[model samples]
Target chain A: MTAALGQSARSVLACGEVRTCLLPSFQALDGRAAAQLLRLRADEHVRVSERPTMYALSPEVLTGVDCRLPTSNGSKVRAVGTVIARAALTEGRLLQSTAYFSAPAAGPDTRRPWGQYLVRPGLVEPFGKLPQQATVEGVLRGAGRGELDLGTIAEGLLTQLRRHALLDRRVPFKSRPTHLRWVARRQPEGERASLTNFTVAEGGLRTMELRLPEDVPAAAAAGLCEDLALHDWLLTTVQQMLDNSRIGAADGPSVVEALHPVVVHLLHLWMPRAHVDAALGHLWDVLEEKPGFSRQWEKLSRRIRDRLALQAVTMPHQAFSPR
Target chain B: MLIFAASDKGGTGRSVTSANLAYHRALAGDDVCYLDFDFGSPTAVAVFDVADAREAAEDRGLHAYLIGEVSEPERIDVWAKTEHQVLRDPPPGCGRLVLMPGDVSGGEFATTDDNLRRCVDLLMKLYHEFDLVIVDLSAGRSYAVDMALEATAQPEMSELTARWLVFHRWTRQHVAAAASLVFGRRGIVAGGVHRGHDEEALRGAIRFVRAAVPDPESPLWSQVSPTQSAWMRKTDGDLKQLASTAGIGYSQVLGSVPLEPVLQWREQLITDEDVLDSQIANQETWTALSRLAARLTDDKYWEEA
Candidate 1:
């Protein structure tokens, strides 16, 4: 971490990838087990809070990557630095792993010592002048072969956590994992933070481009994106589940079978901006106006509940049958 | 449920047959994932008719994932990506069919602790997302087989159900080699036991699939002379006796595919169009594959004998 003055002195581009999936347990974990499950480093401590919700976040770990940056226009810019990764468990049900790094406007022509990179936890410096526009677009487009891949680093950390001995590797339901790639362009001081775009692509990939004012740390932007990613994943996953159910096209029992888990595990995870920083919380308003994430979520959750209610009214005995 | 397909020798149609089984499961409304673990020569892409995916996953395949070069292996949705006309449009209620191809140039390598862990992680992830996970291992007692054995024996996988399908051709040498690969001193049972699996449980979890078996009663052989037919019957009886004596009897056999020219030449999925419309593949071949796919998770079929 840089000094307080240095944090806002220069313009930095921050990018990250977050993977969200079910915790792979028959039941949601408690605070203690959640902490134990996310204890990635032996010497570090896992922060757990139960006030707002059962949340346990692991200490940040670093993965060193020295490779070429992915550019939209094929501008090859080499970078050398560490990528910080961390895991978080929300309400002991949904697990997320985020790997992110910030890059300054420019750096020395020659590579610095490894220790120098380690001290600056999540800062990746370009060899020469950094083309802010190309790098941000590249990250949103995804890295090419031999380029620095934030998704790979994030997935590696998630894989490590999913294989922890503390987990039983049993999931309550079947749902595909989702990846959200995000890039935040730092704005001048005193400017308002705004979300530029949120695009949902095929193959469970979602990209977010944002403009954040100075004084809000890159980590906070990462947090806002993570929150957005988690909720978007929930929406995407639940929608897919319903679509696969073939509600009117299929039988009532099958539709209920498909929508049952969303009611049990994910219905309560709709607290958007609950974990995002106060300053960045306003940025969600941009999305609230156009696509309306909360609006879509409320509608989806209502459909699930209404289906259950309708099933109960029609077939009471089969509605609550053991799953 | 996880199903691993292995063979003691190559050219036994192990990869093709397993890919067909995955296709059948998906047709039956079960999300199926076919993992190409044949590191020496990955060919599931050819069987699934997803040729473009092979080049796309050159460096991000299972090899890269297991060796820690990449985080998650590249997955190709077969229904959406297959070039074959019949497989392009999925039937209603048909589940997803995904193929995780191996590196185009990856060769067999020694299994390390990290590799085994990655294998277990991949299997677990697939088990949670898909209804059936079919991992086609490299033929013979290669590192793929070793890694599969070790990964399934881990404690995290204890509660999950896994079964092994050893594929072989219908021949004396192939039968003997397949049996020895499962029951011999250095076979799967022994290897699993050495790697902390229960011997009886491991033995019960394995079943054999005989490919390219020529049925003597078929109409195609009706033109043969009586003497030739009698000799073929005698030879088939002799092979069955040999199998029983070698400990891979009828009870251990899941199903056998009739020698069909389509499977031999195409090495692709036998869609219903091939049988009902095109009349290119034999009906018996389709029936055999359907039975094999059904028996994969049928507890009655896998019961200890």
Candidate 2:
């Protein structure tokens, strides 16, 4: 899906994948260090915003792919262009890297020069006619072997940032990474963006479908998905911690130890739409209606607080007797 | 924890034993990733019973990754992809088991600065994601070992814990070679120290594993004549003294694996089925592997002598 720059004749679909994980560092980085850690490109600027939360975003890096686009109908459209990868640090604790590109409806039958595609940044022009619906489904299903893999590109960037000399390579907690795959179909101009579907698949994979207005940039849609993925990861990680601890089955001290990291690093970072574009922020309402992300987060956070309080109240006697 | 499995020579069962350690760790609820850094002969796929790894490695394997040919290596989830009958059905609460195979045709290459950086990045990422990251290096003082030493000695990996295991067989030459591989000139200790690793700390992290040991008292050897049995026992005692003198003494040894027909012949993982249903592998070998696997993470076993 090509970002609508008014130069591209028509943009059909935009797709992206966001990989979220805990930064492997014993102590959270400050704003300067976060920016230093995320400086992917030397020339481009690394955006650092601290109004709502401490967030540092790296300049985008490009990966070239000349492979067949995955299509549900098995249509053969060999796209050749660059996929954009960028790293984002939220509160210096949670880190996310996104790889996204937009594909136009159609292009010349033959291949173009690599330099021609480099100018477009995050656009992969398809060969011949493109079936938008089938391509969207194909992307969500994931690329076949030897196809353009956005997840791998994003993960590669994440791995690169994680190996920076600035990092200590020590994680405060053991938490699994989460991946969110998102696709947005272009709507008519002046139409409000809307959410189509949100699926929580097994194995830490989440799928998001949206009807984006034609004017919205692909980067903004990526931002919305990254925001959703970060909070979703927080909720999933905390819930898993609770489940693994066996709160009711296990004793008090163990439960408190399990939930400690949640309070330290995750609790205050739950501001949804903090970085999402205003036009696409409404899409979050659809997710809030059913399996409410914020509601569950609050419930889990409160449970942790109550347990900590209870332990504080009973610690004097229990500490003396346990020894 | 990152465990580097190395050996002074080939045919030491280093790859199979290390793969088994990774498998055992995953079975015990610790997420594990085993990387096949054996660039010359990438045979880890056979050990895990992943049939299509040769093809997959051709597409995008660890070789492609380290050499900058591919951005990311293809990781095969052992449980989902393995053709092994028992590993197909993952037991409840078992953690993830992943294998990062090397390119089938990836011959040995000298280490460059970029290659070293890539190696560090791969190990650091795996270290963050998995509870145990077992990297099976090629035998002797190869480029793979040099790259591993340089990668772990980097500043980014300073906070991470890394250990080394040198595998050798039960023979005079093997014992002497294993000792020299660690303490001799141009050995792991020397190489790591040359690459910024603390000499004492690196020494503490290195341990020796004696593979293919034979117990004369076992029933398999009971059929021998009295003189043969006596000779076998005396030889074993002499080998112990030789090993101690070589500097890989009792304290430095992590564990020993008894010689089993399965490991020697098939060169495959000796699963529980081999002991119970198949009856192809000896129970003593299984128990020894289990004990070695347990001692891998047990602090008491790793304490510096």
**On a 0 to 100 scale, what is the lDDT of residue B266 in model 1?**
89
Q: What tens-digit string does per-residue lDDT give for candidate 1 at A1-323? A: 35732642265788999989888888899999998998889999999988677788899899998999988889999999889999898999989999998888887688878988787889888888898899888998888888999988888888888877778788888888899999988888889888888898878899998888878888898788788888888888888777762654665577777776888899987888878899899888878887998999889888878888888888888777875
Candidate 2 local Cα displacement, residue A254, angstroms: 4.8
- Model 2 agreement with the true structure over B121-180: per-residue lDDT tens digits: 878777877889999999999999999999999887887889999999999999999999
Largest lDDT belongs to which candidate?
A: 1
Model 1 chain A: worst 10 consecutive residues (lDDT sum)? A1-10
Question: What TM-score does chain B of candidate 2 reach?
Answer: 0.98
RMSD score of candidate 1 (Å): 2.7
Clashing pairs in 1: none
**CAPRI-style docking class of model 1 based on DockQ:** acceptable
- State iRMS for model 2: 3.0
Each prediction's interface RMSD? 2.1, 3.0
Pick the DockQ winner: 1
